[model samples]
Target: MPPGRTVRFSLSLCLLLFSALTGAFAAPVGQAEFERGVAASQRGEHQQAIQAYLQAQRAGFDQPALQYNLGVSYFRLGDYAKAAQQFAQLTRDPQWAALAHYNLGLVARRLDQPDRAADHFEQAYRRSDNARLRALAASALDRLPGTRADAGTTLSATVAAGYDSNVALAPDAETVNLSDNSDLFIEAGAVVNHRLSADSTRARYLFGGLHLRQYLDVSEFDQQSLRLGFNQEQILQRWQLDLRAYLDNIHVDSDRFEQSLNIAANARRTLGGGRDLRLHYQAGLIDGGARYAYLDGWEQRLGIDSLLPTGAGWLRFGYQLELNDRDDLEQNGEFFSYSPTRHSLFARLTLPDAGHWRYTLRGEYRYSDYDDPYRISNGTGTTEVPREDHRYLVGIRAQQRLADRTALFVDYRYIDNDSNITAYDYARHQVMGGIEARY
Candidate 1:
């Protein structure tokens, strides 16, 4: 089908499916009335058919399926709000929530309440099992308000634990190449959002996270970290200003604690499409104090992130220049100074699907260089050099319509790594599959 027609049909199909689920003949109206209504509908007697359907409904025919069909008929009769209302009701049904959420997004979109549409689309994208439909909804979200006035604050958390075959003490330094490894990593996080002005001229967002990791291979390699940060954005029409601060603390089970504080303020240009172009610089100091295995360091970075439209796709391109200066705190004359440059590119696409489904694809490439880097070994007498390398990754995701959830996915990645000191090169490829479920 032509692109133009495809969009039109997608809309119609959503309405039809949602309505059909809510409309059927009412009980006690008798089979005869139902047949008459069908005959009338076939003969273009829509008014008569509607009356018969209502009679059936009034006669106690209120099954869930009947309700859906009635709603569809009403929608076909040009009653959108009624259709929306019906779809909304089905959003709670275990069997119908997926399609219900999709239709709900359409209803909200037609009503000119884009934020509501966005919320529903997000729901649909997260709940649907159809890759194509979820992808479409993800794209739709980008068109909606990235920062809506009434948007609810979001909270997120992650917990990860994996068994490692090899764990080293300063793997970059090749201090010990111990293969017997045991480590567990866990994190918890939360965030809150507040709009500081009626026009959103000023806004503040706050977040915090906690991390704990333990390694068995190194015998006594356990560490914990805590983070606190806040960013305030000042809106100056098309231009934007931001102020940010962060504190990070690291506690080692076998060593004393170390911490870092960083403060940064930056300016950004609105780049349309829920994106921005930013130029930023940051300065910070890391201090291990008098009782640590190594000396502390000074760190600084200059960065630029520009949203660019590439051939057949849109991408975020960014580059960072970093400087690090460290003095040996434990011993004299063991100091190092280094600088590194990093660049990254990311692209994303979301497309519509048949039957309320959607799909999404994203690709990313990143490269980094270090001037004072040394070799890294993988426990088995291998050396790596501090050089330039890149990582390539791609992900494909899908959302289902009938169930209002994401049920499938495909992902792939490739990595090329070279060490500075030992001149070691490591390359890897990976593929993954994932599922999204909603209740």
Candidate 2:
């Protein structure tokens, strides 16, 4: 038999062996727990699924498939530590090994261990045809520090500012329809990282603005946000792991507090040079009225992304399917249930030539529907209605690098979107030119 076919046969036999070794015999609860877990997962109840599957595992359901499912549950529930622990059991079995390694990298990223995360993404990317996962991993390549910072611990602070033309995101009008007023936002933060060892195991924790946008005109439209989070990293040759947590708040246009506290862990593996694949599962609770505006109901996301090698550049792909279901927009109520689904896809290409002018081509699409919002807001008219929106965007960028930390650039972008919610359909055109200087 051919080697590729041989590996497939070996994988199949391994699965058969795993089943026999763990089953000894199937327990009574095996079917019941599996069924319940499946139902919960379908309903987007990850935590409940985790508990149900754990019960099944305790009842002697030891298949690698079951174990992989259990790991998925923990990941969706934002228990990265537990999820990683569960996935560790399946790495020995080729059937799910690649996917498990992919998921491990995502949890590592959530935990803020970049090097380890990158390694895992690389491994998974090489092992699977999931091109999307590979691209997601490659995107992180640019986010990591360069060779200069590779030598020792360093303090890095980042400040980014951009202006978005439409601040209120009102219904049915292009940015051209809205008054010339644009949304202004500024974000700045500092990070302290310490290299734990030679393999570049670094610890990173950041405290900064999640996003801050102030309407140049109205005080009611001003926004101030604060976010605090920490992550620990353990970098490995083929795998990476991270543990993380975050707390955030947003006071937008003087609206009530939009508070969020989330905890998650993710890991990634590298399968090829400059290629990666990853999986991510995160769970979070929103305590505020904003859920009434967006999906507004309690929300959660479970998704995967990959980066793969192409001729000259890499292809990027990601899928984030999220569900929001809450009974009351007031965050306290007995009636009303609104569940909306969101799925996002991303694509981008980076130019290969190392020149003074760097360029990237990128696009993104997002869809969101809110069924009820009242369950999250105070008693009065808080239920968020269900709506679906589709967006398509493409942009090109040009840059001129100059000496003395001075650079010039120009950007042109076009965005088109359509939504059932009267407030969402519109087109945006932007052209900008500027010079940036640093001391």
Candidate 3:
């Protein structure tokens, strides 16, 4: 065999035998044939290895490692179906179950059975104690056509401190109300997922999250938000469909600001070579506080997202159309209706990891056009003009993994808004650092 191929086989077999030989086994009657099979495999004579291993099995010398070696030989010979069968037989052996499942996943993928591949990979990820194998299985699961609920329930939390140049998104320092501040924020979330199909192609999940933010000097800008949601996903061949419903509540300065109910649906299709295309739609109803009742509205959005490979990284692009219709637009001294149509474009680049660090860069642009002109009252009296706004955003983030379940990250973002109305134009910059832990 080629040196590299021999080394690869040796590494895989070593992992397989790590736990398989912990218990006593009877003396093999077919020891000679078994040794011959191992020698044949070392010489890259996979057909000869297969014949020898079969003869050994017939002589009552069956063992987990023997079956594993047989499966590997069949795989090398391009007999994926037989390889899958051999691996399946080892799934009952505790020591080799996860390893068998991992190999079965590879065979399934080669046979063009993505759903089965996902199932096997999920099993391997859930059962394996080897960190490298678990990571490989998880990566395979992510690239497959389905959602895996094998992880069951999970809890996560995050906290960060950051500075914001424009805390209220005001146009400029000369605007009516301008504030720059630093704040601390914390978030906690939980999710529970259950499989709904025996084939592992359908699942339902419940999720909830809470976020709180406190500004050091701006008590009136403190914010809190809560979200509860449910999601269902189904996989069919190369297509995956997701349905979601959620409720959100927001409070600012200890006063209720907004409450909303939202519904969304998405469909994604794999286009080969780690590429994917998705289409989504969302609708929501918004209710506002007394001072912001004029902003109460119904919102609708339709969007598309695509992922493509760019050298060693991935490029993601998205476009969406948004429409908002306010219930009572001419309230609270607002002269014009608060209805608008918006078009948004966003793109992100995720670069390959370098050593322990990973990097991402993103940009977004949005244009909004209102149905009626905006009116503002000033010292000179009332001014009116057709309302239009443009917004640009860019951000970069870097993360380093400190351990298996821990990471540290730093991020920076910039935003610039231009509008025919000065009160709505603004420029801002922000920076933040945070650490995350998972269990």
Candidate 4:
């Protein structure tokens, strides 16, 4: 053979052999890259994992597991749009469809698209054969704004049995004729929200609730309340705003107790860094029942609150101011007034979820100064003095998930009311445990 031909043949043969070797090792290299990506992801190094995953993809490694991991890495990196895109592509596979839809729901929720989130959750719930996944999807659906009860409706129901330390809310030093000062009670409540219309920026709903409490030993203290309302929510500029109007009626011992018409408006603003601020105003016109006509009043309240995210949970704190104007009447030549200006401070802390368990702690303090004097019986004589009240409350609740939309909860509350008038001072403790279901 000629020298030139021999040299060219040898070089070409070597290049062909090298190419064959590279092709033979490509899959292994891709798999190694995928493994590295998974390891980085497990270490919470999402950015590093993303680079390895992209390298694997470039090496022609196309796998469902790889795809899922890549999507999750993107999600962890706060690139929700890219994560959503990756997940959306996997929905074509039967095995991955449920999971992909579930992740898409999470992305939509993070983006504040409730309707889209609900749709995705519902799809996941329907398509999933795995019980745990279905339950998770249902729980996600329950958390959405207007899709709980049924499509376009929100519903929740709870039943509890508890003991009240002071059924009459009477002071310890009072000498009133009462059959029972403490009682065992059972309570049930249901709330419903039905969506009327919705768009990207605004939504409307019809909302209502029913609550009933029965005392085992103190029948006269049994109470029932029914409320019906309408709510409108909208986003304007950087604020989300809500307007609500409702009519509420209360019954005690099977007789009418009080009735009120209420209106409220609230606005929420995101302050970045996982914090939010809310401002609200509420007004009501109250009418007392026949036996308690003197309690008729007009009430107004203004409040501001903030929500702060913690590494392990969240903190919510608020302040409220209340103005009350009630009837000033003279009965049997005795004067009475129920008006007061009240201030309230409240706080709540919600702990991080531990598996399917959740917990919260809350406290509140209130101060009230009466606008008019009350005729009090001191010793053997009646004296008129303006009433001042200080109220304190602390509570805790723990909940355990039982299913997709059901949970068992235990709650405890303590209240202490100190008032200048002895008749209104009281200390009370309540413990309740119950089941709650949402749809």
Q: Sort all candidates by lDDT, best to worst.
A: 4, 3, 2, 1
TM-score of each: 0.51, 0.52, 0.67, 0.70
Q: Tens digit of lDDT per residue, candidate 4, span 377-435?
A: 56777789888999999999999977646789999999999998877899999999999
Model 2 TM-score relative to the real fold = 0.52
| Best candidate, lDDT | 4
TM-score, candidate number 1:
0.51
Give me the displacement of residue 84 in model 3, in angstroms: 25
Clashes of each: 56, 69, 1, 2
In candidate 4, position 430 carries an lDDT of 98
Best by TM-score: 4
Q: Which window of ten consecutive residues has the lowest lDDT sum in model 1?
A: 328-337
lDDT by residue (130-197, candidate 3, tens digit) is: 65766677667766543343355555556677877777778654464534433444333333344333
What is the TM-score ranking, best to worst?
Answer: 4, 3, 2, 1
Per residue, candidate 1 scores C-alpha lDDT tens digits across 247-299 of 87777775646777888878877443234588888877777755653437777
Off by over 4 Å in 2: 1-163, 172-211, 254-257, 289-297, 326-339, 371-386, 397-413, 429-439
